[model samples]
Target: MEFSPIRILGIDPGLRTTGFGVIEAQGQSRVYVASGCIRSGEGSLPERLHVLLKGVREVCDHYRPQQAAIEQVFVNVNPQSTLLLGQARGAAISALVLAGLPVAEYTALQVKQAVVGNGHAAKEQVSHMVQRLLSLNGEPQADAADALACALAHASHATGGLATVGMKSRRGRWVSL
Candidate 1:
């Protein structure tokens, strides 16, 4: 059977740096489109947020992705840091929404497990797996790799219902969410 390709955009949002990746997925195949980071330079909180929002909107406009997946904010030891990150995420989400794209949220654990087959996988592991899976020429930066992983996970879930296809032994049991 033939399958039409779906374009996906994934975002890893941070107060200082936001990462974004775009990919086209068809069946079990994934083709990378672009990946990069948006730096919110030294500025006031509102100004930084404006940077993030505009950056995300520009990416969406350029890529014209059909779907978007974003890494969910995890609570940090510093509540203030977490809150700031959440604001950044809100900015990113706002851009996606304004672009009329459906947004899906995935936790870091979920992204790591889907991409690297381990929930506790380190950033390097996630990067390595993302490069291997996407057949990237070189390892992407940490944040960009994470965004790619998030897109890959969404592809895995949206394409063939393969979220549980090869995960039985990885976690020693069938895992489906």
Candidate 2:
């Protein structure tokens, strides 16, 4: 039996708002499926993480994605905020892993470059490119758009190059380019 790579769930993790998007990868073509955000309003860090985990799990179960693509955590000027973001990311990862799903993480630069041909592209630029590439009519929120971009980047690389898709380090960890 042959399996089709049609469903993908992309996640942009944050302490406050975690964005999610589902996409379909058919052969060389990728299409938008759905996009939304998991908002964790003013709350404690642990509470926010709980919301992220639950929200991500619900999205995964609902979409039944073949694979999951998540954005890697980046540095922030505020150390506290950065730590909180990392926790949110960890929670998201845990949700996927617990659900027995394969995960690929992409850096902000890699996502921007894959979507807009520029590693340093602005959020709006990347969002616009995602909307254009996927032929989305209206504007998608920055986080949702970024999640879609992450899925497209994975699909593009998954079809073409191994390094682009993801590579396993000697330590047996998957790392995106």
Candidate 3:
């Protein structure tokens, strides 16, 4: 039996540029719908957060995705940077939840591994693979490519990509174990 396609929004959250990508998933096949970055500009902390939130909401409103995937924020050497990134990530996740969508979180390593078969793959490698996977005419922007990779990762998990990763789903969200 055939099933209707489900749309997913992928987010690569950042303070300055938050990337978003949308895709339609039908069975095992996935196609890109839209991908772009939200430029929060050089603004105050609250201002930046608001920009991120608003940008994500706009994407949600436009795409009407059933679910979402977000790249987990990693710690940086500078604690300040880490904290700011965490805020951005939270804003992005909140936007999706506010839209009544389930969210799935994946670490950079997991996203890279799922997309390029190497957890340590470079950004250029990821860009190449996403183009191949989606049969795009050219490579997407770096941030947009990362968002697309995150969406692809979530789709991979749905197809039983790896069992050891052990994703736990609850409260309309899927979190890595």
TM-score of each: 0.92, 0.87, 0.90
lDDT, model 3 = 0.88
**Residue 158 C-alpha lDDT in model 1:** 82
The sequence of per-residue lDDT tens digits that candidate 3 reaches over residues 43-106 is 7999989989989999999989998999998889999999989999999999899999999888
By lDDT: ranked, best first: 1, 3, 2
lDDT-wise, the better of 1 and 2 is 1
Question: Could you say which candidate leads in TM-score?
Answer: 1
Residue-level lDDT tens digits of model 2 in 1-177: 444766888899988899998999876677888999999887787888898999999999888898989998888999988898899999999999987889998887777767787778899898889888888898799889988988887776666632443554322223554
Candidate 3 Cα misplacement greater than 4 A, ranges: 163-177
Clashing pairs in 3: none
Candidate 2 clashes between residue pairs 3 or more apart in a chain or in different chains: none
Winner by lDDT: 1
Q: Report the candidate with higher lDDT, 2 versus 3.
A: 3
In model 3, what is the error at residue 3, expressed in angstroms?
2.3
How far is 139's C-alpha from truth in model 2 (Å)? 1.5
